[model samples]
Target: MEKKLSFRNSSFLLLFFLCAAGNVGAQVNPADVRYLGKMEGYWTMKTKLGIYAEKWKRVDEHSWKGRTMRIEGNDSTKMDDMRLFLEGDAIYFSIVAVKDSVGEPVRYKLRVLKAVGFVAENLQGFYPQKIIYRWKDETHMDAHFEGKQGKTTREIILQYTRR
Candidate 1:
């Protein structure tokens, strides 16, 4: 009878520890999830030259998927497919352009520098060495790209409104 009591006590302690560990591992930041969900919608930007549209959707708890297109009059050109995911301790943005022949995605590590924005830098010695996404408000965002084209430096900013 003593041996049976000892076994039961050990089993109960083990189960208690396991449940505690599971709760610790399952804890997720609500702010991070809310930041990702904010992008899920249709956004449009219009310039004198053309119009650009982006669509974003939450894929799961840790990821958001997006597509972008450019329109000029009746012609529409697909720009790229993009994904944002929380990996390890950092957020990552991956892009695959429609005209890319390498057949591989380019990934950027997004580091949140402020309360309402994040910056992604190119680690692959590619054009667009830096990309910044900043929310102007709940309904507006500005995306800025800075890079080099040949010997000249180019910077472009696109302002987007939720559609």
Candidate 2:
């Protein structure tokens, strides 16, 4: 069974710590994963918890590597590693945390790829079974994570800008 990364009444901090695939006749065009290269840069957001930062880079046309960090004062903690890759005609999004599964990533398949952004889903995963990305402009983006915990549903959105 998948673990609940965040409880319904708990802070969303644990989510930044972890956080996607494809099929034929699928709305998702795996080729479009390349367009995400636009995300290649250092992005950050200031939150009550501290500074939440993410760095994305293109590994190739078919892959991109990203890392998330939580910064408090002079201390910065590595939260997770996010990866996007294409396999056959499908695209996948994965998050890996050092303490979880010995750094083995949990993946979500790309289910919605749009002009503004995309959506990946792993309905059977943790607190956030869905990862949605939407870009407001060249350097502004919103990431929405959603899932159900018991009888209640939870959603967390993080707005990020070029850092």
TM-score winner among the candidates?
Answer: 2
Work out the TM-score per prediction: 0.71, 0.77
lDDT (tens digit, per residue) of candidate 1 on 31-140: 56456666788888887668898889999888999998888999988888888888777677777751224766666666443446556656354666666676667888
**Residue 129's C-alpha lDDT in candidate 1?**
67
Clash-forming residue pairs, model 1: none
- Least lDDT summed over 10 consecutive residues: which range in candidate 1? 1-10
For candidate 2, lDDT tens digit of each residue in 69-105?
8999999999888998998988888877412244557
